[model samples]
Target chain A: MHELSIALSIVEGAGEEAARRGGKVSVVHLRLGQLSGVVKDALLFSYDLACEGTLLEGSRLMIEEEPVVVFCPECAAERALASIQSFRCPVCGALTPDVVRGRELELVALELTYEQHAASATPATTD
Target chain B: MNNTPHPPRLPRLIEVRKNVLKRNDLLARKLRDRFRAASVFVASLVSSPGAGKTAFLEKTLTALRAQCRVAALVGDLATDNDAARLARAEVPVRQITTGTVCHLEAEMVERALDGWNLDELDCLFIENVGNLVCPSSYDLGEEMRLVLMSVTEGEDKPLKYPTIFNTADVAIITKIDLAAAVEFDLKSARRNIQSVRPGMRVFELSAKTGEGMDEWLRLLQSRL
Candidate 1:
C-alpha cells in the first residue's frame, strides 16, 4: 500500500526534526485531511513498521482527522461532503459546491521530551 | 569443529521497520527539483486492466510529437506490448516491466529517465502498471496526473476508487464510441467524477474512432 511509503516519510521527516531539536521525540503529530487519499488505518499499520529502528522508533503518531468540506453554491454555505460523493445538497437538492480544503497531507510538528540538566553552580575554570 | 546441540538459533532482528520507499521519495524530490528547474511537464496515467491507456498514448504521442518533443515510459507486469505499440508512433518509448509490483514507484521512474536530457522534452507520460488502488499512494513527480476510466468500465468506478480520483488532477472517460453499446451514462459518470474530485477537468475520447481526440490534444498543446 502507498501507506507504507507515507509512513516512511513521516518517520524519516519526524526523525530529522527530532535530530534537529536535539531531544528524544515522544510523538509525531500529523493532520490528515478527508480527501488526502490516505487511509488512516493503513498509515497507522505501516507507521509502527516504518518507525521501528530510527530515532523516532518509539515515538507515537498523533493524527488529527479533518472532515471533507464543500461549498454550496446555491445557498452559499459550507458543509460536510458525504462519503462516496452523495453530492445532493442537504438543503436544496442541488450539486454541492467546490472543495475548498480537506486535501492536506502534511507533517505539522513533533512532540519531544528532552532531558535538561540543571546549569552547573560553579564554573569549571577560574578566570 | 564440535557442535553441542547447535546453540539456540536466534532470529536476526534488525530494527528496520522503516518504509522501503523513502529512498524513492528522496530521489523523486530531486527529480521534481530538476523538473521545476527545466519547466518539463510530466503526467502519469493510471487505471484498471484494459483501460485503453496504450491506445490513448498512441494517439497522444503521435499528436504531441508533431508539435513538441515528447517521450513516454510504459509499465506492465509482463510483456513489452504496450511499449511496442507506442513506439510505432515514432517517439522515444521504453517499457518498465515490473514482475509483480502492483504499481510503479519513483525509483523506477528515476531509473527510466536516467542519463537522458529532461529539458529536451516538453511532456513525458508514464503509463502506470494499470492499477487503480495502489498507484494512488505514490507520487511520480509529475506536474499533472490523469486517471482514466473507460466507458466500458462503468460510471461507478469513481465512487469505488475515490482515493485515486482524489489524487488525480484530471479524469478521462475513454472509449466513448462504446458508451452507448455498454449503456454508459455520460451524465451520471460526469456527476460521479465531480462528486469525487469536485470541479475536476475531464476529457472524454475514443482513440479508435478519433472522436473527441481533437479536444484532448488541444489541451495537451496548451500544456506544452
Candidate 2:
C-alpha cells in the first residue's frame, strides 16, 4: 500500500538526521497518529523493506501511537476521542470538529551509537 | 596487549522532532502561497473509484468555464481517459499518471502545473486518483478539498472512512438523481458525515441530470 512510501520517507528523514549528527543510527522513533490514515501494522511491515541497504539497516523502529484529540466547546476542554468514527466530545457529547491533535506523522527522535576507536579513547575516561 | 585503549560504543538518544511528510508539506505551503498571490482558487476532489468524480468535475468545468477561466488536473494510476473525458469541457486539462502510486503527492501536482500561468486562471480543480484511504494523507495545496460519495455507495461510507471525511473541507453526495431508485438514505448520510466531521459544508447534486447543480456552482463561485 502507501505504507512503503511512508516507510521510505521515514528512513530518509532519519538517515539525514543521523548524517548531520555524525553517528550510526540504532533506532528511529516515530509519532504516528490515529487519524493520520496510515496503518501501524502495515507501516511496520514495510519499514524493514525500506531500510534494506540503507544507513538505517538493522535499526529498530519505535512507534508512539497518538490518539485523536478534539477541543469541545461545551466542555471547555480538550478531549481524547475514543473512536475516530465519532468526533463528539467524550464528556459532553457535543460534536466538535476542532481537532487539536492526532494528524501527526512525525519523526520524533533517533537513537545513535558512536563507536570509540582505540586511538580516540582516553585512559582516564575508560573504566 | 597493545598500549592502545578501546571503549565500548554508547547509544545516544537525540531529539529530531520532524514531520515525515515535511517535504511535501513545505512544497504544498509554497503552492498555496503561489495560488494566493495569483488570486486563483484551487480545490481538489477525492472519492472512491466509480463515485462519479470525473463526471462531476466535467460538469463543473463546463459550467465554470463560461463564467471564469477554469482548468483541471486529473490523476489516475493509468490511462489518460479521465483527462480526455474532462477535455470535452473545452478547458485545459492534464492527467498525472501516477503509475503505481495510489495518491497524488504535492510534487506531482507541482510538476503538472508547469508552463501554466496561474494568473490567467480564476479557478483550478485537481481530481485525485480514486482511492479513499491513501488520498486522505496527502495534501496537494488546495484551498478546499471535496470528498464525494455517490448515493449507491452506502450511507455508512463516511463512518468507514472517517479520516478522509475529517480531512476534507466539504462533503458532496453525488448521483442524487438515482437516490430514490437506490433507496439512498440522505438523512443518514448527512448524519454520518456530520458525526465524523461536524459543521462540514455538504452539497447533494447530480452531474448527469443537472439536479442541484446551481447551488453547488454558487458555492464554488463564491469561493473564487
Candidate 3:
C-alpha cells in the first residue's frame, strides 16, 4: 500500500537526474531487499502509475531483489538467512542481531537515451 | 520525398547508486543530531490499531512527567482522539493528522516538532500511525523504537509481521491484564519475538491495570 509513495519517490529521484543529464529515461534500476519491507510486484505496479505523466513515462523498472544477510557471532562471518522469519545463522544456528545487509531500498542506476546530433561533436554528458 | 535523415539514438547507462529514502534518512539524521544536542531521549511506538498504544503512552506520559519533562506527538489518519487522551496527562502533546497516508514520515515528525524547544524536554515520544506494515519502512529519528502487540492480537504476530519486529529495538506485549481472559500464551509470544529478533528487549505490561508497568517505566527512565 505504501509502494505508491515509494514509487513516487523513485520517479522524483530519477526525474531529477534525467533532467540534469538532459536525456529521456529508458530504465530505472532499483535494489530491493527482503528486510526493506517493500513488495516488488506492488512497487512495479505503482511505478507505472507514478510515471504516467513524469519524465520516466514509458521507462521500465528493473528490480534486483536482495536476500537478508546477517553477521553470525559464532561463525564470525556474514551469512544469508534461509528464512526471514528467523535471523539465526544457517550454518551454526547462532542468532545474530547484526544485520550486514538486506534493508536496502536503493536506486542503483538509470538508462537514458539521447538522440545523436551530428552538429555537436561531444557525446552525452554523464556523471 | 526528400527529407533529412534522423540521427540514431543511444541508451546510456549511468550509475546513480542512491537510497530511495535518502531524503527522509537525511532529515531523520538531522533530527537525531538535534535530539542528541538537546539531551532529549526520543522513542517511537508502532503497532496495529487498538493495540493500546495511546493508552500505554498516556500512562507513560503521566508517570514520566513527574520525574522529568515529557511530551508526545501522535499520528493518525483522521481523529485527534489519541492526542486528546494523552493531553489529560497534562504534558505537552501534538497530533499529526495524516489524511490517507498509512505511515508517518520523518518530514511529518520534523514539521510537528516546529516551535517546540527540545531543550526544555527530557523525553519525547512519537506514536506512529497504527500500522504494523507501513511504519516499519520509516524511521522517525528516535533513539529507540518499541513495537507493541496486545496479548489479544495473537502470539504469532512477530512471525506474521517479522519486518516490523526486525526494525524495532524492543517488543512490548500490551494488555497483559487480559491475558488470562483471552487465553494468551505468554511463553509462545516471547518465543516468537525472540525467533524473529534475537536479543531484543521485551516488556510485558498492561496500561490499564498498572501490571508490569514499573519495569517498563524503569527502562524508560534509564534511557532518559
Q: In terms of lDDT, which candidate is strongest?
A: 2
Q: What clash count does candidate 1 reach?
A: 1
lDDT of 2 by residue, B161-185 (tens): 9999999999999999999999999
Instruction: Tell me the whole-model lDDT of each prediction, alpha carbons only.
Output: 0.79, 0.94, 0.93
Off by over 4 Å in 3: A116-123, B1-7
Of 1 and 2, the candidate ahead on TM-score is 2
- RMSD in order of candidates: 9.6, 3.1, 2.9
| Candidate 2 interface RMSD (Å) | 1.7
The two-chain DockQ for each candidate, comma-separated, is: 0.10, 0.68, 0.62
lDDT of candidate 1 over B49-129, digit per residue (tens): 999999998998998887888899998889999999999999999889988777898889988888779888878999999
Weakest ten-residue segment in model 3 chain B by summed lDDT: B1-10
Q: Candidate 1: lDDT of A97?
A: 38
Top-scoring candidate (DockQ): 2
Order candidates by lDDT, high to low: 2, 3, 1
Interface C-alpha root-mean-square deviation, candidates in order: 12.9, 1.7, 2.3
TM-score of 2: 0.95
Q: What alpha-carbon RMSD in Å does predicted model 2 have with respect to the real structure?
A: 3.1
| Clash pairs detected, candidate 3 | none
Clashing pairs in 2: none
